[model samples]
Target: MSEHQRAMLNHIREVNQHIENLVTDYWKAYSGIDTWQFWLNAVLLIIPLVFLLIYIDRRRVFQILFFGYTIHVLMNYLDITAVLKGLMYHPYSLLPMPQSHLTLDASLIPVAFMLTYQLGYNRRINQYLLAVVIGAVMSFIFGPIVHAIGFLKMYHWMSYWVLFIGDIIEYIIAYWLTSFFFHFYRNDEPTS
Candidate 1:
């Protein structure tokens, strides 16, 4: 490699190591399993999943799962960007050295979105309208509660309104993507 390439590699390695050290220190001081905050995050991660299992429509389970997975993937990407940009962060996590808001991004948020989408689909409710209501609840209600309880922190650049917008956008995208796939599948079905 050229000298410039070698220097860039070294710089990246240094940055990664610095981040890892910070995560380790942060975990020991605030986010470890011994903390109540950790338990709260654990509950946030698991309870929604249990509820989804109990209440999900068995006939449409796969469809809902796909929608939820889309939301989870999109949220993770957005959250990781926010964390890396120093816009927002989780103060406590179910796992040590967590890089992003895994509990919320992977579980609670996705499950909530999934159930709401299912409801909207089954009832023939306007999906965009449902997205707005659920997004508001997540951004205005749940976000504030988590922040108040010291589970989430935000820098001056971030606001709950921005989060609400982000949630709505992701929800819409996931809904469209899921719909597209199912439409394609139905059209591709073999004739008798």
Candidate 2:
């Protein structure tokens, strides 16, 4: 391999290790289960994901999936930092980390929302507006629903608005990032 490749690999490894260390330390004080909860969290996270993949589709699949995955990575990493720093809180975990197994916060539902925006509108402005709408719904509606369930709980100077802010940030980042990739990926073709 080239010198540049080797250096890049080393940098990536360093960054990954840093992330793992951060995640580990952040959950050090939190209660985690070794048996039933592990399976429960894993099942909760994976079930929705499986359903989403089975239902969503086609020429736009990659755009949605790729963007969601990118958002997932960024959201999870940031969430790890945020929780450690007291910016957010959750009451469950699938692993001994800051993220849940189903990763619902970072996956499936948000991706489904993105798919809706992507399919329902062809304009970027429209998508942004839609994201705002969805953010509102999440803050005003879904927030209470999940909070009502033990699946989610809030603490330490946080509110539904904070949840909405996270949604807006996630959607905005995902939209633009996905758009850039889609533009290049579909550049050779013409859209009507």
| Each model's Cα RMSD | 1.2, 7.0
Q: Residues 106-170, candidate 1, lDDT per residue (tens digit)?
A: 89999999999999999999999999999999999999998999878999779999999999999
lDDT of 2 by residue, 1-192 (tens): 999999999999998788767666544544355445445557757876776777666656777777678767766776666676775556656555535434555554556565656554444447777778888887788778756755566668778888778777887888788878888888967788
lDDT per prediction?
0.90, 0.67
TM-score, model 2 to reference: 0.67
TM-scores of the models, in the given order?
0.95, 0.67
Measured by lDDT, the strongest candidate is 1
Q: After superposing candidate 2 on the true structure, give the runs of residues whose Cα lies further than 4 Å from its correct spot.
A: 1-40, 98-102, 121-125, 188-192
Indicate which candidate wins on TM-score: 1
